[model samples]
Target: QLMSVVAVGDQLVQQQHFGAERIQERLQDTLGNWNHLLDLAALRRKRLEEAVDFHQFFADADDVDIWMLDTLRLVSSEDVGRDEANVQSLLKKHKDATEELKNYASTIEALHTQAGQLGEQDRTAPEVVERLNSIDHRYQELLELAKLRKQRLLDALSLYKLFSEADGVEQWIGEKDRMLQTMVPAKDIEDVEIMKHRYDGFDKEMNANASRVAVVNQLARQLLHVEHPNCEQIVARQNQLNHEWAELREKAEGKREELNSAHGVQSFHIECRETISWIEDKKRILQSTDSLEMDLTGIMTLQRRLSGMERDLAAIQAKLDSLEAEADAIEAEHPEEAAVIRERITQITQIWEQLTQMLKERDSKLEEAGDLHRFLRDLDHFQAWLTKTQTDVASEDIPGSLADAERLLNQHQAIREEIDNYTDDYTKMMEYGENITAEPSTQQDPQYMFLRERLKALRDGWQELHQMWENRQQLLSQSLNLQMYNRDTRQAEVLLSQQEHVLSKDDAVMNLEQAENLIKRHEAFLTTMEANDDKINSVVQFAGRLCDEGHFAADKVSKKAENIADRRNANRERALQQMEKLKDQLLLHQFLQDCEELGEWVQEKKFIAQDETYRSAKTVHSKWTRHQAFEAEIASNKDRLVRVQQAGEELMKEKPELAELIAPKIKELQQQFQ
Candidate 1:
């Protein structure tokens, strides 16, 4: 019935298209119904993003909770491990969380991007176009939030590295100074002589540098308030220098104290950290001796275990051999089924080889894929950076696109307004046979007055909806059945509107497909990578076994060789001590019968001149040794300092921006010296 009415109206629309009011009504109804469907589809797509965002929120919250719990556990521990003040772990945890959030934010950002793409499909639908604007606005706000969050994390991390390093340096310096004060007086005569060579300026310089670092760190933090990247980069560079300087100073101070104490020391100078470190290693080796023996026993157990696997493989091979022989004997006995048996055997063997090769390739590919994972991840991010920084993708330019959209939107606005102006309520009521009219008229009977006045106003245009409904009854009939063409028509309109909204997304989708496909492959590739890792681990273990075999022989030789070298190095100091002892006994032997020879011996001693000026030769000799030792130590410190400087230079090279920021300060310091 509705179709017959629409067919009558369709004949009129065929003559007038939308130029006539009746035809225009049908157009509006169809377009409105179409827009509604498009809106629903867009809504469905948007809900997916909301779902993803909800998932991300819960996951991120869980991660934050886990991190807080882990940190709390360590903080609450009554018996803290050596790494109680593990700044690295703290930094790493913070870094990981920051990065994870960035990843999630980026994904949300990508969805925002996808929504933008979806928006492009709704250009013809005014309602969808409006909704697109709303989404873009929301995303722009979210984008700003994400960027600020990342920047804040970076600022916190920079400050943390500086202060954390300062704390470590301070602790180290305190312990070093304590060690210097608590160390016992020089024992051996030769040790006292050696001490003189190595004890100047190390502590003094460290104390000064520690002070410098503290001041510099405070200055940097104060200066780090600027929001600009240049200012931030400058402060971070300065803070880094403070950290490096603090490390160098404390290490240098400790090394100096060590040098001073090492003079005329025992067989191994505990001052040479490597010496004590080696001793500790030896002790640890002794401690783990039982474990090593157990490991040897386990190796035998492993060999015994290998026998079982070998037997299993051998049994499998034997079954295959027996099956082949049985097939041959069957063929000889009954030739009729010989061909079928041969065919089956061939098929089985072929399938086995194919399975083995596939397994091998799967393992190999997985490893290869794993090795590329980091590179792929970096590459992926680099691509993301490109997308983020794309010249065409402008948040600012969206307004312009929207302006174009709004212009078209307003044209529809004009059309709606024009229709609204003419369709007065009273004019439509008379056409619909209601007891109302456009004009206030005097008639004794209310019904006649209402009907006559409304009829007189029937020539009024499409301002009123009732007039639209009454005059265009055929249009209304057609509209009531709009559900028939609802989905297909609206979806197409919505899709068209979105593309025109943001032109860049249409441009970006050309690239997004490739990336999406690659991401899809990532999960499968990760599994393969794990399998490959096992193979690589096996190779590593085999290499370690080979090294262990060589180390067994090398260990025996090292034990013998290192001892001989130790004895040889100790020879010079032992001789110096002996001479001091001999000289000390000189006074006791003075009344010997061979007085002249004794006098000559005394004369030839380094401490005494031939002129016999009552020389305390031993004292003088010890003083000279002290002077020489002090000079050597200073030289060693200078050499060590050069090493630290070189390392710092190399570090600065990698972070060249740091050099650009710091070189001015260094130059100013140099000029002050000059």
Candidate 2:
């Protein structure tokens, strides 16, 4: 109604009616006063309701607080069970208690809500607020205690469950371990196969139980993840389970490998036996027919049979290789029996090798027998060639010249080449004779004795022929050396005579330049003379060597060497005298030239020192430094001057004739020095 009146007044005022403003103001003032009175009356009613609510709140709060105290005592109880069953039973009761606490949650919330309402109504009422806070505090404590109690129960249950599960797994592992430990190893193939089949099933069963063990591990991990009170025990149980599980697996795998190796070894042994029997049979066949027949047909039959046997042996080799591989694997799998197994393998291998050897020897003997007639034909041919070669090698013709001797040596070498061409035939025949004589059946044959005698005669003839060829070759080589020596001696003597004639020439030098040229010419002449001397010495040495080697012309070579040595000594002495004369003239010329050079150097230094450029202050120090360097240079040339003077004096003494030549240079140099 007041809203409608206010709406009507607002419309009249907006329309500017005559009394609308006055009436609106008066109505607003009256409503204000009425609202103030209603506020007072509401405050009075709220106080009355708050008094009643405060008492009721206290009552509900006290009730909840009392129940919480009892619940706290129950939650704080240390009655965690010692076993799975006990813990499980306690867990169930704790669960029921938890449910009851949850049921009371709403009632407690309601009372809390009431307290809030009462406090909201009268904020100055500390007692009501305090009581409400105390109830809330107790409620929170009860909740935490209950939660902790439930966790403890759960921890205990989980611990017990883990223990139970771990015990079961351990029991299972132990049972399996004992079974594996106590199992009898297979002794044969059949037994191994049966055992392997059973172990496979057992392994699968063990693998299937792995999930059960995993469950136990998962339970333990959960307890650990949550940090259960029995964390130490949980970890210990987990480690033990893991250790035992690993060990059990190891044992199972070991047993499996053991059985497998047993089967492989047993199979290997059986195959080895079969291979051995086969090898023995083949060996007997080889031995029975090992005898060689004198006829081609019989020998061919034996060869074909041996070839067939070899093919069979080759086929059996694959089986042996397989058996060996199997044996290796078994040995790798089981080391304790490796030696025995390998010994057996080695014995069988030895037998196989022996059979192979027998086959090889038989084949060789057959081949040798087949080659007998060819051997005899080659022997006869070789013997005839040896006899003819002996006649050629033993020829008594002596070479008289280098060409003849060289021709003879070349002919001997050709004979040697021919002998070399038949060397393989000779070796083959000798081997044939030895083979025939060495055979047990043929040892007493007259043909064998003849072959032996023929071989001995051939060897002796070959040795004699070789020695004859060597002797003839040595004679021819020595004849060639003698001819070379004679030719070299003649040539050396001619060269020495030419060089000696050159050295005896009367060459004269006019001036220093002419003397230098003459000295160079003399040096050249001496070089030529030295070469001639070397040649003559070589001739003499060659003659001496020929004498040492007992050459047929040693006496002639010695006389030629004496003549050549005399000529060589005379030429050398004359050449030395010529060189000394030329050198003395050259020295005189060099001394005169040195004296002239020293005089010029002295004059040059005197000119440089006589300069007067040191008068200026600015140029004084530099000029003095240059002047001092010039003086030091002149001082250094004093040695050159003294050396030149001494050389001039020495030349004047050595050759009094050169004193007239170098006296002016020495005097002028002395003047320059003074």
Candidate 3:
């Protein structure tokens, strides 16, 4: 049991030595990690100090060093726990310090960039100077506390150099100093001049330095108080001068506008005056006597003048309108003058209208008067033509003269109607107030009354002459009929005398019939002549003589017709016996006449058959045959005896011998046959 105890003790001693070796190795490894942590912290602290030195905002560099030292102390402590918890605590402290150093470094970098820009700024301005002073104080503080001496010193010296080179501040300070130095008392005018010059110079310098305005203004007040003895009076005088100058400028501008308006008004007024002159001239022309005597040429001239006047009036009106517009532009200033001009224009327009009306009335009156005058002349010519036509109609035939006179009367009537119409027109003109000075007199005019009376006389005379001509024509026609009746009576008497010796019953009967026709014609002529005797006095005696002659001829023809009737009754019974006796005597005469030819053919009494006897038939076959042939040959001798007896009666009137012999034989044969 004691040997086993001794072996346990030896085991315990070996285990203790092995445990000591492991603890020493673990401590050595932890010490090495702590040393590395210290080195990293130290490097971070050094960089943080350098950042703090470069810019004032990095002043947190000391806090990083304190935190690193505390962490190292914890790591090197003998009694402290060097376990995982302690190591983690130490690592956490180092990380916190490192993060703080990074934050500081970032802040310092931004501040350094700001300081660099500030160095280039105009430090003469108050806000910039103030900011520079504050930056300088912070830089000095940072320089004293920073561990990186070289960078801190460099940053502090740069801020100092920027402060020193700020020329804008020196300029501002110099201006203020000059303003104060130039201040002087105004004991005399010369002193005032000298101080005024000094203030002018200070104002000129401060005008360029906008940042030094407050100090410059303060100094300017001090100088003004010293330079002027009565500062308030001088300021008041200056203000009054400025006020007067403004008033003068406004008045001058108003005067310029007024002058322009006045020129326009004057120009328009002149134009109006000229237009009025033209109107007056036209009015005078319209009132003239020549205007009343309106010929074509004169009327045309007046029309041309009126046209020109109208154009002038239009021009004047246009000018007036332009003037009115111009007046409206300045009416606020010149209302009374514009109103007066407008009134004048209105008056001129009224006068022009009156003149135009007068001219038109004058033209109408003149034209009416001219028409009346022409009508009067035409009436005179018509009267003369009518008188000449009346003279021509008196000497002409009824048919021709009446036709021409009626036509002339119609023409005269037409002209008279036209004259009446013209006179009515003239009366109308008078009623309408047309002053027709040259109008011909109408109602009391001698020529018109004379023409009317003459026309009535001519119509009456034409009717009387027409009646006379009709009476004369009837007398002439009756006279011609009387002459024809006398000629026919003489012709009937000659026809009755020619039939006085006609013993033939047929010839005497024809004579009686013709006498009856003559008697009938004579009765008709007597009736016509008796009917027209009163109307035709010149033919009454000649018509009575013709009637007597016609009655005697008709009575003679009737007596001869009665003789022919008694002779016809006696001849009827003896006609056949007379015809036989005439034939026997004609045979005896023919036989005795052909005795030589018969003696040659038949020496004493025998039939001689010779060529001459046969050709002439002068020989008889027997005494009895010869006698019968002789009787036949003389049978037509009765017609010859009748013709001879009638011819013999005509010969008896002429006392011819053949009539005496033939009449005796015809009378003896007629007595024997009866």
| Top lDDT hit | 2
Model 3, position 291, has a per-residue lDDT of 38
Over 557-651, each residue of candidate 2 has an lDDT whose tens digit, in order, gives 89989988988888788878887888887897788678777877788777755756533436667878876887788789889988998998888
User: What is model 3's C-alpha RMSD?
Assistant: 52.5
Candidate 1's residue-wise lDDT over 1-674, tens digit each? 64565576777777875556767587568667778989999999887866565455445444544544453443333331123245444545545554554465455445445444433333224543444454445445444544554454455555555555556666665665555554443556465545443335445656666675676566466646655344665566666665666565565556555554334232222222332343344334333432322221322232233333344446544645665676676566547656766775565455445534543543343345442332223323333433342322222221123344444344434544544563453334334433322334434446455435534443332124334333333332222223222332334334333322422232111233443443344334434434443433333343344345453233433343344334323433443443343332332222121233323433353243333544343688776876677566546644433443454355456546456533443343334222
Q: By summed lDDT, which 10 consecutive residues of candidate 3 come out lowest?
A: 501-510
Residue 401, model 3: lDDT of: 38
Tens digits of per-residue lDDT for model 3, 222-294: 5346553434543443344334434433543443344445545565566667767867776786666353335
**Steric clashes per prediction:** 28, 0, 1
- Report the alpha-carbon TM-score of model 2 versus the true structure: 0.38
TM-score of 1: 0.19
Q: How do all models score by TM-score?
A: 0.19, 0.38, 0.19
Candidate 2 residue 346 C-alpha distance from true site, Å:
8.8
lDDT of 3: 0.46
Clashes of 2: 0
